[model samples]
Target: MIEIKGLHKYYGNHHVLKDINLDIGEPGIYAILGPNGSGKSTLLKSIIGLVNPRQGTISVNGISVAGTHAYRNEISYLPQIARFPDNLRVFELIRLIKEIRNEEADESELVNLFQVESDIRKRLRNLSGGTRQKVNMILGFLFDTPYLILDEPTISLDPVSLTKFRKIISEKKEQGKIIIYTTHIMNLVEELSDHIILLLEGRIIFKGGLKDIYGKTGSSSLENAISMLVDKNGK
Candidate 1:
């Protein structure tokens, strides 16, 4: 559903992304794992057109992402750190997000999805960090876009809420949505990803399904398997 070809990004003398090529298929969660400074965030930003690559091309559903807002409507992204107006109520913030996306969201649906009915009137600043993360998660899922890019989405989320969020994502996957997730948590990657893309020194060293990783590492556990890959290929 998404293709990135020969992508390259640089910061002065330092190269961040190097000749990266990726094909992300639909209906499955793709996990991107890399050490810090390996350009995982840079790759995500490039896909969203927030960071322009010095080389290569990105296309989504047969449309080029060079200079168009049309492609933006097809995807939703959740950054690692999300900040909202401290004074805005939960419902008000959600309403604002829906309006910004030019979407007519179902309030009750969101309330049930995030279980925010009782908390809707509370200010964002008064909410716990986990609840704030929930708000961000709901906003990312609100529009039901075809492609979702989530970075450290489980951070600050309570175990119950994380489980609920996982269920929601699983439902989305069953519906054939494309998901790209980035995180340091190996366990979540094992549970959620069908394909794993490992980035090392600004380039992809491994790209294949989880089963392929298992076979390559000769490990039964996904975490142990990925640890092997990371240890071998990551810097």
Candidate 2:
């Protein structure tokens, strides 16, 4: 389980997160949604210990994120932008990450799933944007971890790839892994998320199941409910 208490973060004079208290105890897909600059990325980073909070505590399965690096072993993160050594070939990058993490990985399944097997010999600089994104996905899921955090993971993916991505996420959820991700695609949220955390001005304005959000906003669709929330809050 993940526990957050009194979480607050600041960037100079700007407050990015404010008094965030959340408890995630179940294994399912959680969609973090907010408009630009709402601290969605910051919140995710805070969980992964990439960003430190000014005053707060974050723990994963009873392990504190502060002043510790061991907890990261249980986490697999996919950033919004994946930057790798351009000179390295796809397979080389995979082998390097495996060697760095020192963990057994079933990357062949992922590589086959993403249909990147043919390009494994190509250098990172030569792959197309979509292909690179596929590679990013493959790396992110290559390791079997208890927690997965993906930021803008569907970016640059085609419809067929997107479908495969969804299937992979669903399979992970079924395996009892905690999946936390941020995406602007409401249909994807409606289709995949078991719960939604709506952030506004660095605060969680709404946190509940999809039906609960619709009921609260009196909107029929997830997109409309989000727009209504934004309008209601004047954000």
Candidate that scores best on TM-score: 2
Give per-residue CA lDDT, model 2, range 1-235, as digits (tens).
9999999999998999999999988999999999988999999999999998999999999988899989888999999888888999999999999999889887888888889989999999999999999999988898889999999899999999999999999999999999999999999999999999999999998999999998999888999999889778863
**Model 2: lDDT of residue 63:** 88
User: What is candidate 1's lDDT per residue for 1-235, written digit by digit as tens?
Assistant: 8999998999887899999988776579999988877888889889899888888999999788988778988898998877788999998998898888897766577568667777889999998888888888888887878999988888887788888878988998998999898888888878888889988889788889888988899998877876687788754
Least lDDT summed over 10 consecutive residues: which range in candidate 1? 105-114
Number of the top-ranking candidate, with lDDT as the measure:
2
- Model 1, residue 77: C-alpha shift (Å): 1.4
User: Number of clashes in every candidate structure?
Assistant: 0, 0
Residue 95's lDDT within candidate 1 is 88
